[model samples]
Target: MTTRTDSDHDFLASARRTLDLEQQALAALAARLDASFEHACRLILACHGRVVVTGIGKSGHIARKLAATLASTGTPAFFVHAGEASHGDLGMVVESDLVLALSNSGETAEITALLPLFKRLGTRLIAMTGHSGSTLARHADAHLDVSVEREACPLDLAPTSSTTASLALGDALAIALLEARDFSPEEFALSHPGGTLGKRLLLKVADLMHTGAELPLVNHGTSLRDALIEMTRKGHGFTCIVDAEGRLSGIYTDGDLRRTIDHHGDVRRLTIDEVMTFGGLTIEADTLAAEAIRVMEQHRVTTLVVVDTEQRPQGILKMHDLLRSGIV
Candidate 1:
């Protein structure tokens, strides 16, 4: 029951107008993409050394993000502040490396000053600029046009739509290189091993399954009471049943025990084989934990037996194991 005010309406309108301007700028940018963009991507892919991204002002911020995106997506790249490069950071660039310079005006003094040194060192240059006729673009082997018709800023001086266009263009380059390199999600996960994606891709059933003495295992013909004791001791809510050859034969859970009592009025007379679910869902120890979760969810079960090629139970995994591993 809050009252709307004139200021609130003005704020919403301003925000929407900004978004519309930026969206139009992106559409224009996309429409103008040509062989220059492809040439830039090819230059990066062909470079023997890393991609050295440098820029100044707001363009520098966009360049920094572009470098990060490239690095994470199979392109080895890093950012060097243009202002810092003139002082001493330029030494990080080698002849084998390729330079990607960003400048909205294409005449940024800090960036323009490094052009001659880059030429002397035989470093390849690719420029992204709002003005293709500027010196930076003239010297570049490949030039990308990121020019926008107008800024989202009300005064048309705050670099709103231009920056968005540059950032979007950077994403296009990263994703193009990602696809060109045939990058896989598993490879992406390796770079982000500390996040949830890493857990989903790198974690395997063997990594979190209960093994050795911790597994709740009972031999065929073992009494239901003894199986329940093993389940309680292992704390997995279920026990694996195996034959004399030590191969997994069936499984017994608390649910099965309850049904057994209801059907046969059994107390302590039932054997593990008498009520166990025959050949219950099993997964390979090498299977991904995320895939295990999929199987558990698809079947509406909470546990799975880890088995080898010979169908011998190696370990036991439960939904709790996946949840505790932060893979769910």
Candidate 2:
């Protein structure tokens, strides 16, 4: 029976050893990277159809993640279970497509069984395996050697260090392809529209601004009291003061009211034009909402009027809108 103190010490030592072994494996993988890595990248870049990533068990899990990373970064890819390919999933492979197979031993029976079929379909194969001379590697058009000196597992049987090496190599390949294609953040956002980065990159001012009846508008010559009513009615803390032609001439806000009270004792005798700041901070409707946030932060304001090409007020964007849309 081991004491709790002994067990804790053993656990910590084991964890440290495992991490050190895995880090060394990654370092070795990086040092040994040669033309084969470039060859793999070229195959993926030239692929006319989607890359089908396949493996079994733990390798299969890594394959799925690699496929997702590749897809999100600009390469088209999807995962298929190696064991199920012989049943019917192999039909997904086509002549123009490419196959990326992962197996630590490079002798996964289920994966090797599909090799002849992949070759028959005239699909290019890229193998990520620990065994360089294995049948899978021998048959591959490009072989990425993910061999590790030893597993992090105490028994050196579990797929610990080898799996980490394979995953890291897969990431390297995906990022290389991403740079080769010059994939942009906006393009990455298209695949992840529900995420925070997507909101920051894809959302435009037009998408989050209040328009039509929601806009708080008061003409330039309107009385200050009436403009206050409009501002309160819209609940955006400000109102757009426009000219007779409905073009934006200025804006009045809570700050302007404070300045007005200080400048003149009797506020009731004043019109909006007497207190409003002419053509204050404004942004185009086509501008990015992230850019709007930056402008507000730099100028220390809570709202901006959205204008069109003709300098007419189209809509209004408040900081609250950005907060609600998860852009802030």
Candidate 3:
């Protein structure tokens, strides 16, 4: 007696409810995490060989992500399809390897087919499944229970709530392994040097600075007349004020000379120090080029003296220097 319109409306309501229910299930899974996760982390930490991930159907989707996270964060890993393992890919699993298997029912046939072989090869099988007493869990070296109280599916059939729990559990394993190794950001940068974080952590300020004669610099006691010529010659809009030791004493810009002329109006008589901004913005030669931009923006200036540990002027950085590097 129900109309087609009523059935369509029911289907939409059921789909929305499935998503909401599964989202809460994943939150609960994280809340229940404990020492078993530490045990999983230890297994991965001690692994000298690769993590061979295997799963069937929907579980395979989560398995691929787990393998990628593990490889990117310090643990070497790759995915092996469960069905393909029976045909020939089982050769990829070495005796020293760890096998992470995912199956919501704990009874996927393709996964179970490789159990005896994995056990015989001495591969430690780690199971992510909903059933504890299932065959896969029974044979696992470490069984991670991804069980759910109820399926988000109205008929309790589709893999909604169970899959969400499995995905979260996989994330927990990746992060735990990531911290267990004390993986530094520098190490991560080597793997992803083209990205922003990689560029900041791996590249130095010296790599982006204008060095040698490219620097806009003036000698001590130079007249404001000669300093203006140096600033224009270098085209960096400012000139460095250096002591006799080549140590940075101050900085003079077009802005500084303009302010001086507004008050004194005698460029002919003013010395470099007399009109220069005292101890103007400077950064270490080893500082990040990205941080250098913040220095320029914060001071509302365009130039900075790049100094060494001994406070000697080594180079200069202009806003355009950072701009040319595409970091601005």
Q: What is the C-alpha local distance difference test score of candidate 1?
A: 0.94
* lDDT tens digits, residue span 48-110, model 2: 999999999999999999999999999999999999999998888889999999998999999
Instruction: Give the alpha carbon lDDT tens digit for every residue of 1-328 in model 1.
Output: 8988876668878899999999999999999999999999899999999999999889999999999999999999999999999889999999999999999999999999999999999999999999999999999999999999999998999989999999999999999999999999989988888889899989999999889999889999898889999999998888999988888999988898789889989568888878999999999999999999999999999999999998899998889988988887
What lDDT tens digits, residue by residue, belong to model 3 across residues 1-328?
7567764677767788988889888877877777766777788788889999989898999999889888888889999999999999999999989999999989999999899999899998888889889999999888898989888977888887998888888988888788878999878878777877778777778998889889888889998889999999988878888889888888887777778889997578878878787787789988888888888899887778888887888888778777777665
Off by over 4 Å in 2: 1-13, 244-247
With a 3 Å backbone cut-off (N, CA, C), the pairs that clash in candidate 2 are none
The models' CA-based lDDT, in order, is: 0.94, 0.93, 0.85
Candidate 3 RMSD to the correct structure: 3.3
Q: TM per model? A: 0.95, 0.93, 0.86
